[model samples]
Target chain A: MGPLVPQEIIGADWNLFIAFAIGIGFGFVLEQAGFSSSRKLAGMFYGYDTVVLKVFFTGAITAMLGLLFFSLFGWIDLNLIYVNPTFLGSAIVGGVIMGAGFIIGGFCPGTSVCAAAIGKIDAMIFIGGIFLGIFFFAEGYPLLKDFYMSGSMGPLKVSDVFGISGGVLALIVIITAIVMFKLGELAEKRWPREEY
Target chain B: MKTKYMNPYLAGVLLGLVLLMAFFFSGRGLGASGAVKSVVVAAVDVVAPEHTANSGYYSKYVGEGKSPMKAWLVFEMIGVLVGGFLSGAFSGRLKWKVEHFPGITANRRLIFAGMGGILFGFGSQLGRGCTSGSALTGMASLSVAGFVSMMVIFGTAFALAFFLRKNWI
Candidate 1:
């Protein structure tokens, strides 16, 4: 019942307001964590900073745990939340393409938005590229329509695939993140960056 | 100006709390590219109403009295811009400049940045979401798409990092 808008617990007008407030929190946290810098973002791959991995996994796990606890405590209904449907082909292929894009552009869409807001010219160009690329996709939809809709897996969860409960899976993730953070700390020490 | 950024772990915690709050209130996760898609569809519709109406793809978003600008992600992203600007201003990082590896020319960097953006934009459509939507938010909901997309995106980047060393390293 806690999905206030969907459950009619909150008015429709509050939807956009909540979105705005959440976005502010998201953007603030992203920028305050130094996500505006490309070098710092790419550091996850290079082991120079590794803040990306640490922050990323930590955020994911924190939310995962929070949601689980909320569900348990009757604060929110888990079934109301939207889960991304799994498309085997598009998920891998699209992600691969985006990954290549990440290294080349030095920013993901979200981080790019944050960077662009901070007056980053490269990020602005990246934003332009996003529109151009999307336009190309939209125009070429006829040719790629079949491929895009090829995979049709329902909203599957990793926990179910692993035959474990969300709490258990989250626990493992927390433990793994702890180990990764230690390694990340070592990596940052081993390969320090002059900037960011 | 405060140059000190929040500790990464703390920032992560804050970000997580935001995501959780989003789920609690919206029954959905955060997104970035979906808003761009709305803008793109609306732009096309405005520029060529006939074409947008004719196309199966663009027609879904346009021609239905549905203003793409009136989307959740769109409003949230406006807030993102404002919040980002505020953070940058407070930190004294709000200067207009191009950032790149020292080894690469500015032109090369910009060109690659565009190319990457192009690929990501298209790929996000193909994948049905961007890192924030499909990966981060998906993970929060424990969806398989989240894990798969997150792995593939980061894994591919790791695999290609050596080849693109001049760009980042």
Candidate 2:
């Protein structure tokens, strides 16, 4: 019923416009959430701010639940949405690398863009580094193709892997998020950092 | 005076709604790295068309009437820039400065920032997405890849936080 562009309800010509609109909301929310500040984003791991933890999990669950309801209401076709395909080796290794980057760099690609928009010099350099990093990856693609293309699992959902319904997995994740939120609040109290 | 940041939960909900809108209208979630990838692919194609044509990786995205720069993600990213600027302007947060800990030199912070960006950019390609494209969007769809990426990325950061304390704390 939805996914208007894919379903032909919305013309293909409007795709870029729609994408721009969505990005606006996304960037606005991120900036408003203080994701523009690398120091604030990095605070999650330090037991000081914990805003990242709170915001990330809450945002994730909100979307998850929203999708479920949309499907239930027949407003959208859950089957039509894109789910990221899994490549176990790259996923794990890449995640580890990104983890190190997050701690060291303070901002992820999206957040860095937002930070740069507000004229953060560090963020601008970070973006230049991103460009160079991607360039290096492209140059080395011939050597990395084997591993990059390995362990492909086609768009498998967590519910499918666990042999549970999507609803059940959503429930469990919600519970987990609540637990994490509590821990986040506690962490904030235990180690308060002055607001920047 | 700078306005206080929005409540995290409220911001999260707003972010979630935006993500939902993306899925509802376009049938995909939010992404950041993919747009960067598109730009990279485009740049490479322009610099060395034959190299890209011969390369296994770049070939997948370029050629055959496909214009990488016109990608949906690219337009979305441009919007993100505008939106971020608008929000920053409204909140009185727009300023030309380097954000860093008082203990560290700005140059040191810039160097780490660049290094971190490089690693993240490389890793995002290898992982097929960064935080927004993989972890957050993946989790929203309940994909195992999403959960795994989320756990590992956050886990590694937490594990290494102590070592990087001098940079932030």
Docking outcome class, model 2? high
lDDT of 1 by residue, B1-169 (tens): 2337788889999999999989999889999999899889989888899998899799888755678888899988988998899999888998998998898888998998899899999999999999999999998899999989899999998898999998877
On TM-score, the leading prediction is 2
lDDT of 2 at A4: 92
Poorly placed runs, candidate 1 (over 4 Å):
B1-3
TM-score of 2: 0.98
RMSD of 1: 1.7
Please state the interface RMSD for every predicted structure, separated by commas.
0.9, 0.8
Error of 1 at A128 (Å): 0.6
Candidate 1: residue A54 lDDT (0-100): 78
Model 1 lDDT at residue B143? 96
Q: A1-196, model 2: which lDDT tens digit per residue? A: 9889999999999999999999999999999999999999998988888888878888899999999999999999998999999999999999998899889999999999999999999999988888887888888888998999999998999998889988999999889888988998899889878776
lDDT of 1 by residue, A42-126 (tens): 9888898788897899899989998999999998998889999998998999999999999889999999999999999999999
lDDT of 2 by residue, B70-146 (tens): 98899999999999999999999999999999999999999999999999899998988999999999999998899
